[model samples]
Target: MGQAIVVTSGKGGVGKTTTSANLGTALALLGHKVCMVDTDIGLRNLDVVMGLENRIVYDLVDVIEGRCRLEQALIKDKRFESLYLLPAAQTKDKDDVKPEQVKEIIGRIKQLFDFAIIDCPAGIEQGFRNAISGADRAIVVTTPEKSAVRDADRVIGKLHSEQIEEPKLVVNRIRPNMLKTGDMLSIDDICSVLQIDVIGIIPDDDYVIKASNNGEPIVINPQSKAALAYRNIARRILGDPVPLMSLEEKPGFVERIKKFFKLG
Candidate 1:
């Protein structure tokens, strides 16, 4: 059976959807048959992020309501042969689908895919519960801010209480310069507070925005540090011993030339 992993955050705007899209794409690139499920319901954006917005004829709700078959609701990715998307209903509210229904849907999909990556809704509400109901593992995305870390702590506790122990952590939007200047929290600080293993550290890169705006995930961009970070995360998910990328910025052409000539 495929592993159903939920990508969640206790707070919104922490790159949960972006992580889901990129990680699913990365996994598919690594030759895994991956299916991404958007459980955000009314505010569904995974379809847009994966550039399948125009292809979403049947959504998760339709599948659960028996309006369509699971295969009919799956939107196949044009870029990746093994990647598929099951989008949430944009017109329906979060309360429209119950937790058991989401679990049943995930259970059905697991039989056909190598991974079921669920993009969970923000906050620890019913939406959150529904997203995690069928998950074998959970990836909690957060920034290195106090509020984000605090919320992650709360969410981790909730996951543990619900028997989803040892949920992995992804520190998103990391600014190395800010960390060097002591302007932002370090990864160590966040990990120390959350007490969970850090699975990924995504750098703050403008390429992420450009890719998302173009309906492309940054993981496909070879030049993007954020992309490399997410790819590492994907490998880690597969139990690979990939080391985390160094958070320092690489020297520019001029700086490299100066260093080589010993003229600095």
Candidate 2:
């Protein structure tokens, strides 16, 4: 059976949905069948990020409430045949879907793909519990900011309490300039605080905003730095020992030539 993984952030605006979208697309690009489930219910954005929003006919609520079959709610991506999206209900509240129903649907869908990535809603509440109900593993997404890291720490504690231990961390929107200037938390600092394995480090790329605006995942563009990081994370998720991307700014051609000649 396919493993269900939940991408969540205890605090909102930490790129959880973007992580979910890119990771799912990256996995599919790497040749795995992927089903991305948006469990945010009333605040779903995975479909929009994946550029599949206009194609959603039936949603997760429809499948669980018997309004539609599970297959009927799965929207396939033309770019990647292996990639599919199970959009969240636009009209339903978080409390409307029970944890059991979420688990049941995830369990049933696991048989259909290599990986089922669940995009969890922000905050720790009924929606959070429901999103992680059937997940085999969890990916806690956060930024380098103190608030996001603090929230991520609490989320790690909550996940362990819920019997889902060892959730990996993905530090998003890391700025090299900030790190160099001592204005942002370094990976070392964040890891010391959260004490979890760092699975991914996404740089703050302007392309991400452009991609979001155009309803496309950054991962689809291999040239994007954030895309490379997401792809590496997907490879790591598949048990590949992919090294994290270097966050240091690339040397200019002049600097490279100077270094080549052993000059300062």
RMSD per candidate (Å) reads: 1.2, 1.1
Residue 224, candidate 1: C-alpha displacement in angstroms: 0.5
What TM-score does each of the candidates earn?
A: 0.98, 0.98
55-168 per-residue lDDT for model 2 (tens digits): 989999999999989999999986899999999998999999999999999998899999999999999999999999999999999999999999999889989998998999
Give the clashing residue pairs of candidate 2, or none. none
Q: lDDT tens digits, residues 206-240, model 1?
A: 99988998899989999999999999999999999
TM-score between candidate 1 and the true structure: 0.98
Whole-model alpha-carbon lDDT for candidate 1: 0.95
